[model samples]
Target chain A: MALLSIADALKSAIAEEMRRDPLVFCLGEDVDIPGGMGGAFTVTKGLGEEFGYERVLNTPISEIMLAGVCVGSAMMGMRPVADLQYGDFLFCMMDQLVNQAAKMCYMSGGKVHVPMVMRAPCGASNRGAQHAQSLEGFFTHVPGLKVICPSTAYDAKGLMKQAIRDDNPVLVFEHKLLYGGKRKEKDAISTIGEVPEEDYTIEFGKAAVRREGKDITIVANLLMNYKALEAAQILEQEGISCEVIDPRTLVPFDYETVVNSLKKTGRLMIVHEDNYNCGWGAQLGSWIAENQIFLLDAPIVRVATYDTPIPFSPVLENYVIPSKERIVEEARKLMKV
Target chain B: MSKLPEKERMLGMYRQMYLIRKYEERIYYLFLEGIMPGTIHQSTGQEACAVGMLYDLRKDDYMASTHRPAGHDLAKGVTLTSMMCEMFGKEDGCCRGKGGAMHTGDMEVGALVANAIVGGNMPISAGVALAFKMMKKDNVIVCFFGDGATNEGAFHESLNAAAIWKLPVIYVCENNLYSATTSIALTCNKPNPAADRAIAYDIPAEVVDGNDVLKVNEAATRAIARARTGEGPTVIELKTYRHGGHSRNDACQYRPKEEEKAWFDRDPVKNFRSYLLSQKLVAEEELQTIEKSIESDVDQAVEYAQNAPFPQIESALTDVYWEGK
Candidate 1:
């Protein structure tokens, strides 16, 4: 085992996958230049020399074209690892991802399959509204697409491998704060985690329990997962035990794990960076309320961003997104109920 | 054109055009009778464009089509029965009834199920051709679209990629003059036709008389050959017209009656039939036999679709996620 950050784990996984399969390649704007960092987040830093330009392709600054190339190349049997410098740009290529890549298989009556991976660095990073929005909720609404958000180095490496091997279009949303290295953004806090040396993969639809407790169960994704852990630590000293569950993949959601945890704890709270209305957290909250309402001590609570575009100011953006204090206060209310 | 095809080849082309015309005519009447679910974007006046471009493509090769795909699907070898069943939203349809009239195709016969969104199939066809090129397979992909699709972002992006990478794809634009109600005169300002849109990407292009089967076949043959030789993609614009309206209920009020009559005067099946008879390749009696046989074949497809069952409710839950279980 070795101590690896999320960026290192992602870079190592791409390198290994490229070596293992010649069909696997990388494509994005600024992915490879003579002395440039591989993408805005350094997930592809040293890949150009190892794989060459053909494999580590550096494309023009066109998000729509980048996604179109991935869809076209993937349809032809090449496993293209496509990236958007920021998750906010995914809106530019919505037609390609939501229309083409997602529906190709079903439209062809199972005759065709797209084995492509799209990596987008998501979540608020004080880079203002344009670059800091959490866009996973928008993608989850599209059918025939798989959405995976990895919070740790271990999950990042394994899930990236799985996304590469899977015979469908998979979107891996990596949060900016959890990247865990010297990042391009000035305000990102470091939170490195340990990853194993041996090859391993974490399958989609499996939730990892970060802390075991009994008073209440809190479920979060990406940076929210780390925030939940911090809230659990503070709640422990106040005579309340909070159980934290991180669902790595959102599309093929692990409802059984959350249901079982809810049955034991009798209290639940859902958290995400997207807005409260129509957020993925709303889907989880509704599921728990519908399927396991009797087991809950009170109504399911969801902590999410206010329904507005991400703001430019650091103070306003933090207010829009859920904070550690908000989580603690929400957990206290659930304890009361 | 191409040294006047031998008598037998000319007769074969005539028969295929006849089949498409008869098949689409049958579908139009059936749709009017409320026997088929969903609306249709019929290709009544555009038979030659489909048959001519697809006749030379092998069964292993592929074609991606648009919302108006019945003609292309039939030309690419999808059977009339399955196509009819799909139109009726039956369980045995090409897409198992998940896709209806606007999207009808059978992939086993080298046709990707028709895409309903305008210009959505362009990039996909490029990908299919890219796959064949990467695998070192001599297969080619024919991407069919309307003149309106040329304005879509996908059209430019797919063409640039296909041209730069030398992908084995033939981009065939059936410029029926209108994308629904909007005319090509309003959409494009280029001198010749939609095929010239490809020149911007530095690929070979040509504008053909879409109603003439021989002319369309010659242009597609050249493009397909260029793709097979790994030279890159070609764009062929087939200047044709559709006799029927855009969809099930449309009466085509936007077009003038005289112009519609003029196109009907030059029906592709009739033109090909006259050409064959003039060359002494087929007599009136042989042509009648072919027509009768195609009529009966379409009758059998309607019968099959009428008797086929609807898909069960469970199918809605399947094929969403492939777990490999």
Candidate 2:
């Protein structure tokens, strides 16, 4: 094992996949620009020199055109890892994703399968609301699309490979702060974890139980998984053994793991960076209340961001999004019941 | 203008136009009589624009169509039976009945199912051309759209990209004068937007009389040859008119009587048929036999669609996700 960041893990996955299949290529803004960060997160840096511009394509600032080209290419037997420089810019290509890419297979009645992956760097990082959003929930609701978010380096590499190989269109939501990307112009404190030296794959729809506990189970995704781990550490000292479950894939959700964990803890708390109302957390919370209500001894609490836009100020942003303190407090409250 | 088609080739153009006209007319009556389930955006009078361009295309070549896809789909060799079944929402439709009327197509035959959204297929067609070039194939894609589509951002962006890349694609604009109820004059200031805007992208552009199948066929042949030879994309504005309304319930009250009559006088099928007969290429008796055969074919399609089974309830969720895991 070697110390590797999320960006490096993704870059490695792209390289490995490109080597495996000649059809696999990446298309987006600044993806192949010499000396430019591989997109906004540096995941695609240096890919152009290795693969050349034809394979690692850098396109004009046309999200719709970029996505349309990817979708059209995928239909014609090419595997394209299309990216939106900023997750917020995804709105610009909503028609392409929602109307074209997602519905291509369904519209064609399974005759056509778009084997493409869309990678978007999402999360609040003191940028204004537009640059920051947990938009996976929006795509998760789309029927033909697959949504997956990987917080760790290992999962990022594995899930990305699966996405590239999968026949259907998959959307990989990577948190901006958790990328562990160091840019020439800017840098942030991030944990660059140890990635495996050998090849491995993390399956979709499997929940990784970070810390096992019997008192309460806390479920989260993306950066919230890191927050849950921190909250669990602090809660351990107070004798509150909080179990943390990181659901790698959101669309093909692993309900069995969630139900099994609920049976042990008898209480559940869902945490996410998305707004509280109608967020993916609500879907899980409602599922537990509907399907496994008998296993729950107390109510299912959800620690999510406020139903408001992410602010530019770090203080307000922290207040709006769910913090480690909020997860611990919610877990404690659920345990009391 | 000098690249005129032989008299025999011109007669073949008449057959294609005739086929699209008869197919669409049969579907329209079937839809009106409540035999077909979904709505239709018919291309009754715009047959030349569909048949003229698509007939010269190789089977491996591609075509991207607009919402009014029945004519284009038929011209591209999508069986009338499957098109009929699709209109009836049957399991045996071209798209397994999921695409309905607007999105009817068969990709195996090189047809990107018709896009319902205006200007939506523009960029997609360009990408398809890009793929063909990347694959080192001489195939070209003929992207068909309405007059109103030229005003969309996708049309401009896709055209510019195609021009720069020297992609093998033909932008066929069936300028039928109206976008739904809005006139083209109201949307675009230029009389010939497709040809006029081609100057901006530095791609050769032309305007052809869409009602005259021979004229349209000649223009399309030249354009396709240029693209095949890597001369880059060409924009052709086929000045035609839709004999029917945009959708099922539209009576086309916005069109004046004189304007409608003028277009009706120059029906593409009739004009081409007259040319074929005048040139003695096909006799009236032979033409009548062809019409009778097409009628029988359309009749069988309607019969098959009427007898076919509706998709099971489980089918709704079947193709949503490929893995279904």
Give model 1's TM-score versus the native structure. 0.95
> What would the per-residue lDDT of candidate 2 be over residues A64-99, giving only the tens digit for each residue?
777878787788888999878788888888877889
Q: What local lDDT score does residue A317 receive in model 1, on the 0 to 100 scale?
A: 88
- Choose the strongest candidate by DockQ: 2
Best by lDDT: 2
Error of 2 at B75 (Å): 1.1
Task: List model 1 lDDT by residue over A76-194, tens digit each.
Answer: 67998988889889888888888888877766556567788999999888778898888888888999999999988889999999899998999999898888756655555565667
Candidate 1 ranges with C-alpha deviation above 4 Å: B1-5, B191-193
Among all windows of 10 consecutive residues in model 1 chain A, the one with the lowest summed lDDT is A182-191
Candidate 1 chain B: worst-modelled 10 consecutive residues by lDDT: B316-325
